[model samples]
Target: MADVATKHPMEDEVKKTEASSLVGKLETDVEIKASADKFHHMFAGKPHHVSKASPGNIQGCDLHEGDWGTVGSIVFWNYVHDGEAKVAKERIEAVEPDKNLITFRVIEGDLMKEYKSFLLTIQVTPKPGGPGSIVHWHLEYEKISEEVAHPETLLQFCVEVSKEIDEHLLAEEEEVKTPETPSLVGKLETDVEIKASAEKFHHMFAGKPHHVSKASPGNIQGCDLHEGDWGQVGSIVFWNYVHDGEAKVAKERIEAVEPDKNLITFRVIDGDLMKEYKSFLLTIQVTPKLGGPGSIVHWHLEYEKISEEVAHPETLLQFCVEVSKEIDEHLLAEE
Candidate 1:
């Protein structure tokens, strides 16, 4: 976050009145403990959520033109700067998803008053042999006059905001996936009524699974992905569970996610259940209840017993019921 203008070789030339229109560049690199794709996706597709991730600095963001994540889209921001309120309007100039790069050009705001033009680009890449990524922020600008100071504050702001986002990402990755455990086989179907949004509930299980452990830590000790990313079909998830006075673990792969129908299916590939069951599959479907704000959550478990001595899945059903209730209450509290 050092002021590059003072030490840079071009310092005198940049301050010369004759070179007022000369473009000045500043760049900073930060390492964060998060997926590169996830961090890039936050700015590309979910910029509006930045306030939630860094409430102290960013107050809000609104779409002014086109759609989010699209080139040429205009976004307006309300933020705090130098202990004062400020605003900025920017247009997305470029987006390279494969390379995890996004560029924005300042179109209007306080920055325009001092600079002829300003461009901000962010690139993220995975760190080799590590669990995190490195983020690079590059700023290119031309001052309108020699009186304009270098954009040192703006560069510091970006670094601080990146740190806040990195902390949020690291917190979500704390969920632990344990080793395989014993298993059993049987079929059980039950339904519970929930006065909550079906789409929200489905999204919780699909994308924000880290929150699942937070909501029902007693029944679900932790959850982590073994293969692929969360919310994608075929992604494998390992769950640590406490059931019937015993600790258990299950490894399952997502078979389907039908957001339109509010349904998700998971088929167990290996786990504690495999010890007693030949196969196990779980499906959850949420539908809005008639004439109300509630939803009917249907839990279906299909399994083949390894032997006749295997007990039924009564306790398992109760576990699901309790977890669902806990999640319901968590969602309600947030509202």
Candidate 2:
């Protein structure tokens, strides 16, 4: 729990707490009723502080300050919903690992005027013997007026989101024979085979196929330079595609490069690849095979995902695989 002191009480009490109680009038109030369930293995332990990849009220999101995953991080959001792209900024107020409670305060945004102000805090608590964890969507508010819109509708949407997460987690847990190691320590090692180069060592990596029909966003997406100097550190690029009428974009930055070794690291900086996915990083190692050895390439990608978008990684992996196959076929035919 964060030691945040409310600037003032939920609302100003006309007289006093004792006086309000005596008069049977509540000093502070909330028009929301919320509940939760047991632990869902896939999402319960993962970090929660994130911005919707498509930030606006619309179909896409981006954070304000751009620090999407770290504590005390601030991000702005833009979304188009019902034809309106409303924007908002939020800050992570409190984080409790043992208790699984992560809170973000809406410092400024569309929700400010409705209530004197609002604090949005979410908690993933144990439900004892239940199959899924209880996600507590607690919104503390100081309303500007009695006629202000209640947060009930938003709470209702959160409920649906929790259910969706539960389903996705359950399905994923069923597919994996063993649970993934939750800690970052031992989980980094993967079974991806890296065949050693014989003489002039080469690497093998997977890249996505260009979506032929859709024109990618030239600014920050799609097989092109997105930001900064094209090949320098801090430079940015966007990879994009459209699947089933939904557009997908991944934001990445050039973190490091070793020209001598033909190596580059692309860090996911921002974009609309997944809901609540702030940053994803990929490391590509390229080397010449020598003696007509053909080059080898490898890709490593990491991202933060919302419980709802937990399954996003598999899709990206598939894209990598498909692209790899095509590259191999093309190279063989050329020879």
Candidate 3:
């Protein structure tokens, strides 16, 4: 208090000017003619596919670090900017699939020359009273100097890319809806309630699938690992089981394991089932029950039958339900 100093009005004005001029933000919204889920998946899960959607604008995108669709992963993008070829390396800062939002921070590239920092965020929301989506693009940046221009062109580039991606997704959706011939693909799903936690239920299949045979000895006789560690993606596993009163063996590859979502997917590579179905994929997902200690276990089967005469996997789904009940009982007994 003895040496308190007051700031001058001119000083305060200059300080405010400097603070406002150092940082910038730009936002734009685009109307997308694709479903929000599909649009979000294009950027968050399969950004590499963007080049194919807009080959004239985007040359390619590749994983530089970490896996796809994960935060902290770095991706390198080669694209056209102002008719000039440019490259940008960016890190995934955030991903919120529930909200269909993804954020990226530029680490290195042509844009770094003028900006000290740059962040791009995209959020897709379903359009009200419509079948399409609304995509919002936002940019946050800090300039090296006040003379640097705002990145209006980059914002426009994002809008164009979004439209191109939406077009591609719409085309694919149409193709799926009206295939040239009768499609063999079919899906079967069932849900069962369990007296075990979702984590434990998912872990049984992801980490210790071999122990499943102990739980349902009648249905699952044994399970053995053929390659890679348990719970790892791309691992090959062999299963000996009984289906329709006959013993059957299946060799499957673990396609994906999303522990956060309590989901695992297995694709059959060799098995008696493959004889009737050209391809068979099994997905198991668990979700904790609300206001309870148990969980809901969901089994999803996706298959392409070799012919229309091949019956749907109703019996197989029944077998899964029986096995799930047995495993739930086994887990409850352990508890």
Return the top candidate by lDDT: 3
Error of 1 at 22 (Å): 4.4
What residue pairs are clashing in model 3? none
Ranking by TM-score: 3, 1, 2
Top-TM-score candidate index: 3
Could you give candidate 3's per-residue lDDT for residues 155-191 as a string of tens digits? 8899899999999999887878895534678888766
Q: Rank the candidates by lDDT, best first.
A: 3, 1, 2
Residue runs of model 3 more than 4 Å from their true location after superposition: 1-18, 182-335
Better of 2 and 3 by lDDT: 3
Q: Give the per-residue lDDT digits (tens) of candidate 1, residues 1-335.
A: 23322233334423333554456777777778889998898789878668878888998665656677899987778889788888888999999999888999998888899999999998888887888888888788888876888887887899888988888766645522223222333457766777788888887788877689888988898989899988889999999989998999999999999998788999989989899888888898876643347676778898887876888777898898999999999899999
Alpha carbon lDDT of each predicted model: 0.80, 0.46, 0.85
Poorest stretch of ten by lDDT in candidate 1:
175-184
Candidates 1 and 3, the one with greater lDDT: 3
The true-structure Cα RMSD of candidate 3 reads 13.3
